[model samples]
Target: MAQMTAIKVRGKRSAKPQEKWTSGKKRRKNIAIGAPSFPTFAALVDSTALNRPDQRKRRRRHICLSTLEQLPTEILQDIFDYSANIELAFTSRTLWAQLRSQHVYMRLTTRILSRVLGYEDKERASSTDLAAATRLLGCKFMTWKLFRSWLEEQRPGVYRNTDQFLTAWSDLRPSMDLVPPIKLLRGPWTSERLSFLRIFSRAIENLLELSPPHYEVALSGFAEAVTEGSPNAVGMLLSMGLAPTTEMVRHAVIDSGCDKDIVIAILSHRNCEGHVGDVSTTNVDLLDPALWSWAEKVRRDGNEKGEWLTRLLRSKFAEIAAVPDAEL
Candidate 1:
């Protein structure tokens, strides 16, 4: 044992000379601790956010270490698979940067949306998995254009129109039955429709809002919004500079209970050159008794507790009624 110790001591002494560098200029100085130089929260949001949520930019990042990071890659991946909130993984820049590269997370998100929505593998297609995975990563990091190309490949035949293409490709769309309330939207819906809307909200958010001009698509998009109980989708379109057609307003009136803000938004933007869209309808005047009856029924139900809506409906009707029939 003493010989071994003597040999170890000799080895250390022999290695010591090799450790010394023959020449050196100088060692680089270390950065100061807690430099107070991290990008501000507002700056991160500005740099990371794109014109649309799906476009993100690489920005200066802040990082923190965690014990979970030491786990083996496969083990940590399994843990990530169990997490429903992808944003939680985003708490650490390293984790977000690492996990997004794993295709397994994409498959995992596919299982989540598919299991909840009851879309079979055959109907939904793998392209949806990729698209939704991009969405799950946060809107800014999404690659929806790539997803759209995949969808086109998946359905070479019926890609007739963008709206239908989206509705069909997503496979997450609410049933037609889920739209229009059972009792004329007396109040917020008490069914599964709202849940569906909220679940897929971000996925469709930019799609409806950022789409280019299309004469025929306005109503179709509005109809999709109405059925989905997501007037905000149409509202987003309005915010994106699409003019509000009366049909859009009518869709809002169909059950303003869930979409009161959409009505307010349209009226607010009415004076903007084309933003208010034409309020023209068929032979029926804006203040038709039947329409008033419908508005009264909606107001009597639960939208805005009935007060504001009732007054607005009556006042608007009175104002429009005074106009000559020819001018209307």
Candidate 2:
């Protein structure tokens, strides 16, 4: 052990030489530490002191370790998805809005899906699975369009009319399932009263066209009033527009409970310009006595309820009385 130690000390004590170089006319000195036997090149290289604080300040100026908030929305989404908790995506409208509208998350998810299972395989699968998947993805419009096209292909021979087409397509309309209700209406329905009335009128017109005559008989008081107030209502019957066939008239008068006078008013008064004729049969009493009795009762009340009831009685009488005695 003593002999090994003496050899290591002799090796350490060996001499090292330093080379001198002249640059232009100036003589530059290369100082070696521990001279004669040993020297540190590391110490020679660091003659200019390291200004650590200044170095640190320089680094800080150029190397900005930016926070996540400083990044763009696309970059932020990519960063957030891997590290963020599940609750972060669902916590509020703001988060959901951020995720759903962003292309970054969509691309990330699509990439992951493509990697796990081949993307093209999904399209080659059965149509039912595709339909369900599309619905899950909230691409309902595309789903229904595809469905309708398939249906049309299957029924190649049949050409549906406008009414039939509307019925067939009704179910494919977009629903308000995802939308919040307050955003839909935006205000109280009270302000929409006139618009409601117009819609109600149009709905009634459609009902009259599509419904059986007996269905009209079952209408409530308010509906009866609306029909009575409409001047064009009875003309729909008398002009053969209602077909005026015995069955159609009976259906209108008996089943629909149409007012007799309104029916007469539509028939006896040409163009229904509201003129009373001099003909004896044109007299209200000379009309169907049963209907006249009902009309008198309706008129006696004279409110909206009365106007409606009287109008109904008058309409029914006119419809029934319009039939020839010979036919009866």
Candidate 3:
């Protein structure tokens, strides 16, 4: 009887705990079904109003989101006043007025133009000014763009006032002793521009200094203009440095249309050098029809000295064509 009673007590205690757990589960289920679930926190947040950035007022209360474009012209002009000076920035009247009115844009364009012209100080510029300069210089349609292109092209009339900006300046030719060795300007070499600079070179000879390299450049340009076969070209070459050969000398005489004084001066220069081969030492009477009579007269006058005239005549000299007579 005692053993059976103890077992019943143990079973009653375990059953009581299980019964309590079942009663708690039933209560929780009843609450879950009966009670209405409130809106989630996410839903609450979603339902509330959010003020967007665009809805916020800009440029003070005067320039509202609704009537920003309808703002007074004077006010607009004042805003972009700096950019107004740049022709490229003010494309339309309304845009010009708007940008001109904005203090930021106005200051920006002014600073940008100054920087492109290399006039503005980098450190002193504001963030707005630097940003404006960057935009203007980089934009293809901007005034700074066109200005740089014109400079690179070396176009005349575009920078006519550039001469006035000079405190003191001289080119590399004559001022070599005075001027420091440095490159002042360089750009694309168009034939027309090269020709123009060649003339400029001559004009500035008195004011400038020519280093050896500069002289070489000028000489090369002159050489390119005239071929060796041309008499005028030969004259120019002789004037520069080349000495005349006896055959060359005689050829010049026969080709008297070319300036003889220039030839003589070239032959006389100490720096002039020449190689008159035996084949080119000949004085040929038949070389030029016009010179035939003079050759005969020379032969007749110097008949007794026949060997000398024969020695003077070289077979190879006949290859030179007479140059058209050119005035100095």
Runs of candidate 3 with Cα error greater than 4 angstroms are: 1-65, 82-108, 111-128, 144-328
By TM-score, how accurate is candidate 1?
Answer: 0.32
Ranked by TM-score, the better of candidates 2 and 3 is: 3
TM-score for each of the candidates: 0.32, 0.18, 0.20
Task: Assess the local accuracy of residue 323 in candidate 2 as a C-alpha lDDT between 0 and 100.
Answer: 54
User: Can you list the residue pairs that collide in candidate 1?
Assistant: 53-139
Give the poorly placed runs of model 1, Cα more than 4 Å off. 1-65, 102-105, 119-138, 146-161, 169-328
In terms of TM-score, the best-performing candidate is 1
Model 1, range 1-328, lDDT digits (tens) per residue?
3554333444433656556332232111123233244578998888867555567556767665688876676766677777655665667766665566536545454544443343444344354443444345333333344334444554465554456555654565422111111111122333333332333332432233333333235446556665566655555444434455555556566554436666666544432244232333222245545445666675676655345645655555445456543343
Range of the 10 consecutive residues with the lowest summed lDDT in candidate 2: 176-185
Question: What is the Cα-based lDDT of residue 91 in candidate 2?
Answer: 54
- Candidate 3: tens digits of C-alpha lDDT, residues 110-206: 4544442332223243444444544443343333234333333333334333242121112211221221111111122333333223322322222
Q: Report the alpha-carbon TM-score of model 2 versus the true structure.
A: 0.18
Task: Name the better of 1 and 3 by TM-score.
Answer: 1
By lDDT, rank the candidates, best first.
1, 3, 2
> What is the lDDT of every predicted structure here?
0.47, 0.36, 0.37
- Candidate 2 C-alpha lDDT tens digits along 176-291: 11111111111122223222222112212223343344233423322333244432333322222122223322333444555545444433543223233322234333345554
